[model samples]
Target: MPHSQDTTPIVLTIAGSDSGGGAGIQADIKAISATGSYACSVITAITSQNTHGVSAIHPVPLEHIESQLDAVFSDLNIVAVKIGMLADADIIQLVARKLRQYTPKFLVIDPVMVATSGDLLLQQSAISTLKQELIPMADLLTPNLPEGAALVGKPVPQSEEEMGALIADLRALGAHSVLLKGGHLEQDANSNDLLIQPHSSELLRAKRHPTVNTHGTGCTLSSAIASYLAQGNRLHKAVYLGKQYISQAIAHADELSVGGGHGPVHHFFNGHVNVR
Candidate 1:
């Protein structure tokens, strides 16, 4: 069988490798392609991980990282970029430098600090470099509750007013826009996410699904947003559509049994007429 040579917007993911095929660069590529963008990748770090947890990490050398970025930006007409886990200060600095050089039209930064299994992905010392350099370059910052709190140097809020305040504080850190994910906020019947732009704010509401197969929700959402942006959708609209896509993914994650703990969402759920 052969595939069609269709022309689609290119989206580059500069992120870490997930041996589990569930998160990091793996999830970014899946979400980007599933949302209609051609996906390219630059591996930042390789992690020994799976459904249970991450055991070890090996950061790619700075020279290799630079080479990969040059290779992609030189040839592909990249419409957008999605960045995930960069394990250390050196890697973060390297990524920030490359981003400044290429300057893609849209950049979605997912500050991947902690993995779903409560393992630390980013080094503590790299937080400063990430905040000072990479975050300000992002057109959109997608951080879950804990990551958002870490970014703002505050505790996770327990109320809507508190969440709104957090968004403002994060935007003050220089990101053009912020999607403060509320999924980690005491789970209830519904999940609420906040999107803050320069002059407006929106609280996106969706029904929360009960499942443990949410290993890569943040990566998926941010990559989907980048894909939508590459397809020419506006920021707010892209965020909304990305939310809808992730909700359905989480809702239907039970259809597959890939691993023993915290399995991945079924990224190909919409590829068929009947997903049974």
Candidate 2:
């Protein structure tokens, strides 16, 4: 008997590889799958790292990167794309070109510059290339405090007021929408994110969880947003749902003792029951 055509939305994650399975393409795949979307990947680089820190990074060759992009975009009916760490200018430019050639319905760019361990994931020089080539093409750009500051060459927002003040600057970056994550505001009582669109802005608030297991948070949130978008949700709805999902993932993070350093949130927290 012939099987009926599958209708699952497919999401592509173009990011780097994390050996620890806590972030990057690993976390993106987990978040996408856990959120009811098919997961596919095109790795830009491979990092030797754990919860502790990134030790070494080996960028995938340009030709192979292009090949992977072609293979996936050509074969898969990708509804949305979530982009993460591009090691340098060349990779960033290549990806920008491919995106132009085969545009996805939704493009979420997580400007992953610095990692949770304080390691530099993207080169300082490539920041210009990222701004010029990829940011304007993004439907949604997700950046944490530090990454946002880097993008605009300003200090990280110290308070909600400061965060609000940067909205105009962030809006000038040319992305259709921007989610400025406030997780780095450790002094704050709540983890608030500013969602800046063309004509409107919204504040997404979540209770701050006192835990260090927030690895791959940006990747997870952006991937979840893309997943929801692929599943036919509006951009605002997808951002709201994605925020809710990550907040819960963070709330349940202490349940898993994955590593000694900053650990990962429980991507499938809703699936299992704690019997003990």
- TM per candidate comes to 0.95, 0.96
RMSD to the native, candidate 2? 1.9
Q: What TM-score does candidate 2 reach? A: 0.96
TM-score of 1: 0.95
List model 2 lDDT by residue over 1-276, tens digit each: 542234679999999999999999999999998898999999999999999999999999999999999999888888999999999999999999999999898999999999999999999999999999999999999999999999999998888898898899999999999999999999889999999999999999999999999999999999999999999999999999999999999998888888899999989899653513
Please report how far candidate 2 places residue 251 from its true position, in Å: 0.6
lDDT over C-alpha atoms for residue 76 of model 2: 86
Superposition error at 18 for model 2 (Å): 0.3
Please provide, for model 1 over 34-146, each residue's C-alpha lDDT reduced to its tens digit, 9 standing for 90 to 100.
Answer: 88889999999999999999999998999999999999999888889999999999999988988888889999999999999999999899999999989998999999988
Residue 274's lDDT within candidate 2 is: 58
For candidate 2, list the clashing residue pairs, or say none. Answer: none
Cα displacement (Å) at residue 14, model 2: 0.3
